[model samples]
Target chain A: MSDLNNGRYGIHGGQYVPETLMNEIHHLEECYEFYKNDKEFNDELESLLKEYAGRPSLLYYAEKMTKDLGGAKIYIKREDLNHTGSHKINNVLGQVLMAKKMGKTRVIAETGAGQHGVATATAAALLGLECEIFMGREDTERQKLNVYRMELLGAKVHAVTSGTQTLKDAVNETMREWVSRVHDTHYVLGSVMGPHPFPMIVRDFQSVISKEAREQILEKEGRLPLAVVACVGGGSNAMGMFYNFINDKEVKLIGCEAGGKGVDTFETAATMATGKLGIFHGMKSYFCQDDDGQIAPVYSISAGLDYPGVGPEHAYLRDSGRAEYVPITDDEAVEAFEYIAKTEGIICAIESAHAVAHVMKTAKNYSKDDIIIICLSGRGDKDVSAIAKYRGVDINE
Target chain B: MSRIKNAFENKKAFIGFLTAGDPSIEKTEEFIYKLIEGGADLIEIGIPFSDPIAEGPVIQSANIRSLSGGTRISHLFELVENVRKNTEIPLVFLTYINTVFKYGTEEFFKKCNESGIDGIIIPDLPFEEKAEIKESAEKYDVDIISLIAPTSEDRIKLIAKESQGFVYVVSSMGVTGMRSEIKTDLESIVESVRKYTDNPIAIGFGINSPEQAEKYSKLADGVIVGSAIVKIIEEHKEDSGKYLKEYAEKMKSAMKN
Candidate 1:
């Protein structure tokens, strides 16, 4: 166990919040402490992952894609096969179980693409807790299917209209709701952000991805991967895949951000590459803001990636030089989307396509013998129509 | 006499409230001087946070404006350090607990002491959860002022006993703002507080007019008018110091007359 009190990679984490919610955050922090050491908590979480979530998703060797690229060996960590069709299930399950153990009866969350909301609702339904999700009006419109899926899972969806009416506004609305109902409801934050314990707790839960990937890769291949790549939107999936590899100095961790047009364009979601420290949605992180501190509008082909701020941990990593962040242009991501479909028969989400695009460029630079593991975070099922529209083709046709 | 103690002995001790880094750091420093010159016996500098829940529209807007002016915890320390060069007005900090926690507890108190601040008023920190801070602040010689709301009688006594310096009696059960009429029970509340501690009771949260100041000055040891002064500064944004001086003189004269 690491002593976070000394600070994590020079990033200080603590409970910085209003007085009213201190007791609740403190209680959650204490619970995290107990669960960190308690065998029962770990055992229960492991059981849920194995039995319910279908854990240890396959590390498929994409030999065809590798041959097509004529470069390094590429393997995909199929997190898309997990419950709810994404790596988000890993965190939602852990948080929902923690909520249940705390005797909380109501769960609230914020979502952009609604994947986390659907997963949270799934967990709440399984545990018989009332669930509510706040999503930005813009996100609800863009990711209408996910919104419908959350409602279908019996979770109420609130269309947040404030701020940019995107993920940031959804986060603000959720925090406001959490403060008023701190006693009875638990706010199951989607990302590894927010005050103190949440970033730590969410990271701890999501770390199972890297923990399993390390063993699976080592067992299948004779040695460790040369690089690990994942898309960074609040960086939950990326953090999950990079946590175990952070100290492995030889292995490089790459995070792909959405370059809506280009880095110079205001319509990008590259927090680490170009953002300033500011407070938004209950946490201090790199935020895309204008000179006056007003949040600027963010654009991305994937609704999930349309956030102005990245996770504080990601900012810390970027600053400490532990992880390297790069932007994948929308055109490049679409090209990768088509390439993966044509070569590997895998249609990746535009968010995941950002990672795919990065892997393609990065693979060409490495030797043919080198290995790179790309986290295929989510399935393209939710993205098929959007991809078709972007390519000026209908899926039915 | 104790600096805070002496001020309360002769007349009601005035506690001036102004947002830190308001307009700008230079303007905030100038505002503080104007406040002290205007007969403010004590000063409460507000450290603006991004989300101020207890603040009404006026104070909330002020916070947003100040944050837009780049007022962070580090900036606040710099402001206080600079102000320490000129005056020693028993400056008390009024901020939420997050800002304190953000700058670690020990470091926060150390910086406060280094800046020559006398006390702190954190409305969010309840008595039960403040033992650690209370102990640390005692070591650092920084008095932690406690607030007693209108609802809690028994808790008020406990707060009065534990609290150092004067007790900040919230005049109403609302956020910081301005109002025309003084609440009727303000005198009774001040009288109730006097039973627990001989320390001065400062009534605040809506003392705008000099008449309200005069009325509170007659009943309580001090009258705090924040939004009124902030409004004056905002109204005369182009020449903040001049307007602040005029407003402070008006407030001080009303307290005396």
Candidate 2:
């Protein structure tokens, strides 16, 4: 119901694409509008979330984490327990269902960390849609397990080899594929980016986190939390957690970006804090660029966070001063990774450790009475080898 | 008539296209003046985007060269600001939607108006999503030019209705580049566009040779030759303006027929 024409609340989302994909983008926009309000669409999405995705993930009060921090009371929203082991399933399910509703029999997605591909494959297998995932050749090597998992889910995986064979390249390949096969296929975008309706639609689907957390927290604590924090990699998890709280003036939104060495170094993707305005993938957003404006390479222990740009909406939020953006160094993130694993017995994804590290540093300023909800964006099972290798420990042993 | 409107009416509108800062900002300024002297009616300064999905190798390399020359959105404003001091030739920015989005839609139009930019042509921004920009741009008296492709008939009418400046009729199917021969269906495309709006239509893309320019001019109100001009400038990279002037004059004479 929001007027995209007004670009209200910094949500000027749309499909600004080449003529090759204009019809496809327009068709998708129409489908999104129709299904977004249709009762049947709502019922189908609800049924999938309840029956398949294990909807209404809990907001667990981390008493031990709270006491250990000794500053702010900490609560963890358990997106880690959802199907596909992350909040990514929430969006994958919504998009896959939309694809089904549009009568598309095939689905394709691009992935860096492989979480999105796995999530998409899970939905495709369940919904009986043919699935194809394009992943960077480098990522396919590093995330062999996920590649195999997608294959096991009956999805064909293509290892992209073009232009810095990574997430961005995979995106390029997926887009090319979408352009060629726009009739019977849908490109299941993995984040709150790309051309319009996508940033809005994906945010709407993933916003269940903030929506449910708001009610669940109010029921238990009788008030809204002072601040909410999440790690940003294409900003899906952060956007999901921040959407419901954006209108609430009382709540502070914090997004932690990957700072590979430090904010001063060239090897980081802390776009909101350090990037200049530039176009990347298909949308305008904050991008890490060199003196000549060519996109510079970004670094992070987590493959997912190793992208050169952040979502356009995050850029808007940063510019609007509605949210505070910060960077978590690789060393600090690793330390937090160890701290959480030893303290909470929960090994978090290296990407999520960035948020935990930020919370650790920020919590020092607040009193024990203040409540801080950190979106436990994902579990650390995928990150154990990298962390172990970083500490010079053998994961093989 | 205004100088810009007069050029169109007299059928002497010299259309110029160059990536904002090719080689360097210093040379870009020099080239703009050379084109103006060679009788350029309007200048289409391309603001480079990283992924120019709709551009061929010529414009793509021009963009790459400009980016290497440290060209940016801020630099673009500076270029327009400097150009305003020298010439009153109508200037239009040819860029992707992302550039406008990053510049903040409202702020972009305001800056263009302040910098004395006369028009904008975002090839990637379709008419369906341009209401806000159209309204904002109209307030500043900045024209939003629209593109009409060879395949476009009904869409050309829709674009013309929403458009403020002259319609840019793409003479071919592909990205901006030069070709030896004009497409066969260009006359029909131009004829179809004439049915839509009373405004002058300029045909671009693939209008390289003088013969092709002459042929295209006979169909449309004006002819736009980019890749060929850019090629001439690139060939004489050290003295881009001198070569650009020579090529522009040749192309202008060809269109005059």
Candidate 3:
């Protein structure tokens, strides 16, 4: 028997799932192992990304924000410009395509901000497969427009009312659904979390972010950026933004977790700040849990960052000091959201605003010669109503 | 001999499961006694977790109610001790791995020994990941019961050979709930398991009615029912003791040779 350390990143990841799902997980691992290197698989996926989904997103320089911050030059890696208006499309297309190849007729996924659900719905529609999405009832209410968008894409959406009616509950519902229909359906886990292969698979798919950003920045500035920043919910976008730059010891990889109201209070989703080591959601990682080891009900204004735990790789990165994670409170993220919208004439997703908030705070400390890249992981269109509500301005949907 | 092993001496065993502190801890104690009175050979006490991914809605709701009632691991150990004071019936814990891991693995096993717990079934702790807690469980003489799902195919024999107490054969592919009929080919799985080990096999998950219990017991050493009983508790609350006892008697008589 293999030890608990199998498929782990420094005692963080493992196959902590029920017996019924073990064989299915093993089969997925085998398929991923085979297809990750298959030339035909790569060719087909690349074409879908380039020709269909519109790859090679722009790395636009934020000249106005750079001048206003009066420090480091800023560039926004525009993953927000993807087909589904988010970085979620990168992994959704890959997994849905793999599902098609595996002879699976249906795909299921859990979403928080509905970005992932929309992306999965889009991919399943394109691939001629049935799609279903599980979203927390709270998220469905907050991101109602995206819910409609998914419905329009011909995907069934289930509002998971269990627990806190948020992202965590949606995951629980999705996992339960997959356990029942593992043979004919595939679970397109949205983030770089869950068990071993999921974290590895999603990270690899999203790594295209840093792969293109690296070449783009190097081509434009003739050097790697001083820092790479992205928001961390389950840390998919952050892992994507940080993966290629991990080898460059000089490039600072910073991940921003949602602080909700504040980290000191119970109402926060800052896993790196308030979480401890415990297993939940099929991975041993940092989880915000109560004394009895019950998973906590985490809160965040940005529904995308409202999860209780960060990915195992993020836990490893924090422990090894290879990367740094900071908490961005709702107030700061909102300020950054409005700041960027007014200054740069671009409204980034509230999830991406967490990273932008971090940059806004620390960019003034960097030298003018320094360059930093912030991954605008999604567009702000889905978050406008929620942000307006947060600002005490009601805009009826 | 281990209490769990002795539970299946000559006759087919009837195992009962319920979440501790559902409605209230006192009611759970009452429910267990009622099961014993109804001729349950062995009992499985669930330590309610915050997130039970493997469970269906019935057991999941029980977990939430148990947690909301302020049921803690310490309370469960005390409950086990209380149950032990009354009967010598074999008792085990059914819970997720995180509960034990968070309570400290070695310390948790030690408490199990002190509280007279015979075995533990962690659904998430598969055969491959058993090394972490196997030592602690062995040190405390607590059997780490192995579960074989319909999907466990080739791994059934591998797990069966190393099994200590009764092997829990899941009756269906999904999470635990009452089913009208089970369609999985469990006879072949049991035959494969019998080739490797002489341990008792108890099929669980969706075995609710007495007819279903009798039907499944014919193919295995025992039949375990959970959600059906939990549904009774959900319906009757604190007054579920007599209903549970009557139901258990019917299921036990149905399974008896």
Candidate 4:
């Protein structure tokens, strides 16, 4: 119903793509509208999520962390346990299935940390669809293991060498690829960003995180958590974690942005912290740009969160006072990465460590009886080498 | 008549494109003269963007080279003003929407009007979202050009009917680049567009050769050649004027045939 309003979240989102991709995007919107209500489509997606991707990921109570923080009762939503090692599979499987239904034989995607690429490759392999992923050349160097993983899953990976050679350039290359091959190839955009239907579609698929978390928390604690926190890259995981809780006026939806060094520095990806309203990547949203409106080359230690803009929905949420976005510095996130691994023995993704870092800094502010839910969006296997190098412990992968 | 309308007067227009400051702003000025000398009816001066999604490698590289050379929107505005003093040839800007929106839409178009820019082609701003910038463009008497791609099957008439200045018919379903052959049925797309608006229709994308321009000019009122010219600039750098003039003359003469 919210999306029925032209896919806009208070004038933030719209279809701003080229004319070449307009009709294809329209067809995608139509297919999504029709299939969202069809029982067969829903049934197939449910089966795929449960059987192949492993649905209903654990909502483990972090007793050690809760006791150590000495304030809120902490619960970690273990999306990291999901197949493909991140929440990306939830949306990928849904979109890939929809692509199949729409008679698409191939799926293409852009990736940052390579989690989304790996997840998309896995789903495409399962459904027998050809898959190709575009990743920044810089990202390929940093996240080489993910490149190998995607190749092993039978997806060809292109090292994009454009602009800053990061997530933003990867997205540009993917859109270019999509425009050229829209007839048989579907762009399985791996974020709650981009033009209409994409922000809406990705959100619907990923909302499963909150749909299940809300139920599990109610069954266990019998009360809503005071705050739900998740890391914001293109803000898919955060949007999913906050979607079901949006109506609960008492619940605080908090998003942690990647502050590469600090929000005050040029080397940062804290869009909400220092961004202005601008349009790029097809959606009218807050973007980190120069005075001339050129998108800045944003930097973040976590490749996934090194984007210049946030999702349009997240922009609306930030503007409407329904949610709050805070920038977590690389130092803080790395510290939390080490802290969580030592405290709970859970080696979470560095992207997720941003959320944990926020929780670590604020959990003590809440009462002992109060509750907090942290959405661990992915596992840390891919980031171990990077984190080790960051901490002066270089271990080759 | 408006400069854009005059461009199509009794002739098949040859529209040439180049990034505003690919190597430097002065060089772009020299290149514009070369295009005019070789017989360009209209020129599209591209305002370099940080991320040009609609462009392929050729234009994308030009954008990077322009930006790295410290070209800004204000500099391009000044470029237009300087170029306007010598030539009455219609000049337009081809850029992403964010550049205009960030520069303040009203202020951007006002500057365009002052600098003598006849029109603008925003690849990212579709018909449905044109209102965001159309008012400002109209206020300044600048035509907000509409692009109808091969994929714009049902929406071609809608776009063409409301199209200002000229209708840009994207010859294929891809980013800007040179292709050996264009397989899309452009005559039919042009036919459908012809049924809606009387404005000139110029076909672009993958049109590099004079033969290709000659063939496509038969179906539409104008032929737009971008990447090919930008590629020439990319190859020759500052010494590109002679080659650009020769290429433009060849393509323009071929279209005349």
Report DockQ per prediction, comma-separated.
Answer: 0.10, 0.17, 0.80, 0.92
Task: Tally clashes: model 4.
Answer: 0
Q: What lDDT is obtained when candidate 1 is compared to the true structure?
A: 0.79
| Tens digits of per-residue lDDT for model 2, A1-397 | 2223522225434455545466666678789989889998899889888888887988988887778778898888988888888889999999999999889999999998888999999999999999999998988977777899899999999998655678876776787677546778998999988877677778889999999999999999999999999999789999999989988888999999988888888777777667887655666677776543556667777778877887777777877788888888899999999998898888887888898998888786888888899998887787787777889998674
- Residue A172 miss distance in model 3 (angstroms): 0.8
Identify the CAPRI category of the predicted complex in candidate 3.
high
lDDT of 1 by residue, B1-257 (tens): 54567667677677788887778878888888887787777888888865554555576667777887777677778888888898767788887665675466788899988887788887656665475377678888888887776655556677787768888877764566887764547767777788888777888888888888888888887888788777876677647877777777787788887
- Clash count, candidate 1: 1
DockQ score of the complex predicted as candidate 2: 0.17
Interface RMSD of 1: 6.4
What is the iRMS for every candidate structure? 6.4, 4.3, 0.9, 0.6
Best by lDDT: 4
* Model 4 lDDT tens row, B1-257: 99999889999999999999989999999999999999999999999999999999999999999999999888998899999999999998998999999989999999999999999999999999999998899999999999998889999988999999999999887799999999999999999999999999999999999999999988899999999999999999999999999999999999988
Q: What TM-score does the A-chain of candidate 1 achieve?
A: 0.95
Q: Which 10 consecutive positions of candidate 1 chain A have the poorest summed lDDT?
A: A6-15
Where does candidate 2 clash, by residue pair? A14-A196, B14-B41
Which residue pairs in candidate 1 collide? Answer: B12-B221
Restricting to chain A, the TM-score for each candidate equals 0.95, 0.96, 0.98, 0.99
DockQ: the better of candidates 1 and 3: 3
Q: Which of candidates 1 and 3 is the stronger one according to lDDT?
A: 3
TM-score of each: 0.70, 0.74, 0.98, 0.99
Worst 10 residues of 4 chain A by lDDT: A1-10
Give me the displacement of residue A74 in model 2, in angstroms.
3.5
